[model samples]
Target: MKPEFENTPLVKAGKRFEIEIDGHFAFIDYREMGHQIALVHTETDPELAGTGAATAVVEKTLAYIEENGKKLLPFCPYVFAYIKKHPDWKRIVDERFEGYNKL
Candidate 1:
């Protein structure tokens, strides 16, 4: 992960966390709930697919959540899979999340 790919506040209210690579944007869409956030979706431009851009965006987003002391409700399947693959990030997951143990 690179600092250059950290949180990009380009979108208002911080609903989007994006990483720009080679002019393509890979981003995660989220909704804030006080100290918790529901990661709703992850998207990468078609041209950027399979380039690991999605992974990087998720990594940065998770880092942002951790750094800000926010709990995660990973509603997005991609994000759920990411957590399943890297269980260490489970620490930031909201324990009350319905699928908590699945990750």
Candidate 2:
């Protein structure tokens, strides 16, 4: 992820986190719930698909969550799987989340 995008949420785009790469935007839609962020969807432009844009955005989102002293609820399947594959991310997950242990 680029340094500029590490914490850039496209306010004009409904508060979703965004990464603009090569004119394409990859985004993760989320909802904030008190101290937790519910990551709901991740999408990459058709042109950015398969180019690791989703993964990059996910990483940045996780980092943002941790940096801000919050936890996450991985409602997005991609984010759940990413946490499963990279267990270190689980540390910042909301333990009360139903799927926390699975991650």
Pick the lDDT winner: 1
Per-model TM-score on C-alpha atoms = 0.87, 0.87
Question: What's the lDDT for residue 96 in model 2?
Answer: 92
Per-residue alpha-carbon lDDT of candidate 1 for residues 1-103, written as tens digits (9 for 90 to 100) = 4555454433323678887777888888999989998999999999988777888888878888998999999999999999999999999999999999788
Each model's C-alpha lDDT?
Answer: 0.85, 0.84
Which pairs clash inside model 1?
A: none
Worst 10 residues of 1 by lDDT: 4-13
- Candidate 2 C-alpha lDDT tens digits along 1-103: 5565555554325768887776889999999888989999999999987777788889988888898998999999999999999998999999899988777
Give the clash count for each candidate.
Answer: 0, 0
